[model samples]
Target: SCLTDTRMMIKLRAANEPLFTGRRNAAKAAWRAILKELGLQGKISTYQMAKKWDNLKRRYKDLKYPPVGMESVADGASSWPWFQLMNEAMEGRLASSAPLLTPVTQDDDHAPDRTPKHRPRPAPPPPPPSDYGPEPFGGGDAAEPSDGPLGDLERQWDALERDRAALDRDRAALDRDRAAVDRDRAALDRDRAALQAERLWLERERAALERDRALVEQDQVALGRDREVLLKMRSFPVSFSVSIYRPVSEREPFAGCRPGGKPEPARNKAEFFIFLNFILEAEY
Candidate 1:
């Protein structure tokens, strides 16, 4: 049961790897997610959880070593169908002796494969011994000299071929990268073109608005002149009249007036009934 739980926990960690991948707290996030799934949140720190994981992995590796009596199983025997079946059972069901350490040999699944450490270059074969030159001895058996100029030449050719292949790969990668850059540049150009078109449309619209505003101003000025002229025309009188009032006191006579357009002279102590009149004129 503990084994199953540990496997589940490991799987949980792997699942959450992408949750915070490439970020600063990726490990912390991964461990936290694992703990949450395992129902161990707040019960253990990520450091302690990682330590536990390392311990389990170490135990699993120990279990992967072949059992005490399996020495007779030659390395080539592993490829045999029965050996594969045995591996499967050990890795799958844990019913076999190897899987007694299921932490390592569960269902006979082979240990995780690792790349062999790079062996340093074989130090260029000592420059093919320049003092020996071409070996004239050995009855000129040219095909037999393993340490001769031919061997050196073959090595050099192999090295050149490797370099050429590496260069070809680099060139292909560069071409792919350049193509991606070109696609991005084209997209940028398209966006810029769209923006330019939008700007031009806006400018034309603004110009049209300006022209309309100018026309509205001119119409307003014309309307103002028409209103002023209409006011003057509406205000003209249809006819004209001039009124004159003559205030003549009875006690003092109307000394400046005569009844029938006659010139009158001044009088003393005279009383008379005064009259008033208004003159009217009509115009077409």
Candidate 2:
């Protein structure tokens, strides 16, 4: 009885074998088609596929469950929401990590509003015709006359005349001072010229004195030479002597000589003649 039951079970499975084989073959072909379409056949490991599915699920945290069906499994159980969430998360991460890549809003990206908040306007002024001229003395229409204490226009004219006279006086005084300065300058020039002439005269006098001194020295030298010649002539002894007694007195014999006899001393007549010639030349 057990062998018969085992045979019956084998026949039953063999009778539906084609249908089961076809289902398994179709499942294999579908998986190959999905891997080829996603281009992750041999490149993606079972562990890597599971990690990608987990990451997708985490990115779409709003979704409570993974997508159903064999197509979802092939695509790592990812849906449109999952992709959108992942993209948004990547954008947020980029923005936080790099300040330069911050998302820009349309309103902020456009030119800012530059319209002024408030306008400036000039204040209105009083009418021109109503207050045309200066306000009458003290805020009244009829101005009080200026005739109290001080006269009117005539007194003002007199004051102006006095001021003009005083100015004229000052101008005349300044003119006089300028003339005096001119006279002083002229006097100084004259004095300088006189001093220069005096200096020139003194220089001439000094030159004349020098010339006179030179002439006097020449005369002194000539006198010394004449005295020297006279002394040379005087040094020789006289050969003759002159008798100073008159002829009548000569009857008495002269001293140091014999009367009417030969003279005891001989006289040098030639030296005496030369001495007399020198004395005569010197005297002339």
Candidate 3:
């Protein structure tokens, strides 16, 4: 659509330029002839005619007349002729109804360029005013030393310090409790070691006692065998014999003589022998 509008504007510009030139020249020539007929040759010259033509052309070109209607242009160069014919037809129809148009004059040096101008940014809003009200220190009227509230804050701080001290004492107590537990655990370990050692000693003593008992049992068995042998030996007994010898002197025999007594036999070399045997028996 923009392309179409641009092409139409180009055609309109081309057609209008030539039309304006021709009409303006014709008007200038007619004015010159009228001046000549009035016998005022000094008033209008060829230069004056050209200047008037230029002014008329500018006036007509600035007129904002709408195009009669849409016209389709197949060829680019043919658009000018077609646009001229259409514009003449539209102008004839609105010759008496349309208002006269004036051109806008522009100064080449002072006129703003086609580019848009950048407006300066407005200054930031001023900062809000400070609120000066009654502060914790004192009112804004005068500086006054605080007596009650300051003392209350100091008391609160002191209370906090006391609480912190109490927490420290509790922590110390817990540390002592932990140390006592550790000591108890060490003592328990020592006691276990002693008990283990005692158990080992008891086991060794039990083994020694078993060995001694075994030896005693062996001794008892040997003593019983000896007793049995002795009993068998004493079951029987046997025994034996005796022998005697004597010598006497003759004088002794004479002294002991009596009338009816038998005289002792004269001492003489003599020998006698006797043998006896005995046996003893025992019950089973």
TM-score of every model? Answer: 0.30, 0.30, 0.31
Q: Roughly what TM-score does model 2 have, to 2 decimal places? A: 0.30
lDDT of 1 by residue, 1-284 (tens): 44455555545443343342333434444555555555554344444454454443333333345357754434434333233333333343433312111011111211122334886567654445322122111122322322224435434534543465467569779999999999999999999999999999999999999999999999998888777766654564422111112232322233466675443544321222111111111110
Return the lDDT, model 2, position 153. 41
**Cα-lDDT of candidate 3:** 0.39
Per-residue lDDT tens digits for candidate 3, residues 1-284, read: 32332233233333333223232233233333433433334433323322333332332333323234412221222323233433343345423322222221121112113243787588898655322111111112112212233435434433543465467569779999999999999999999999999999999999999999999999998887666656744452322111112123222334455545444333121211121111122111
Which segments of candidate 2 are over 4 A away from where they belong?
Answer: 1-157, 239-284
lDDT of the structure predicted as candidate 2 = 0.41
RMSD of each: 24.9, 47.9, 46.4
Question: Which pairs clash (backbone N, Cα, C closer than 3 Å) in model 1?
Answer: 90-106, 90-107, 90-108, 91-106, 91-107, 91-108, 92-107
Candidate 3 regions with alpha-carbon error over 4 angstroms = 1-150, 237-284
lDDT of 1 at 255: 40
Alpha carbon deviation, residue 276, candidate 3 (Å): 30
Superposition TM-score, candidate 1 onto the true structure: 0.30
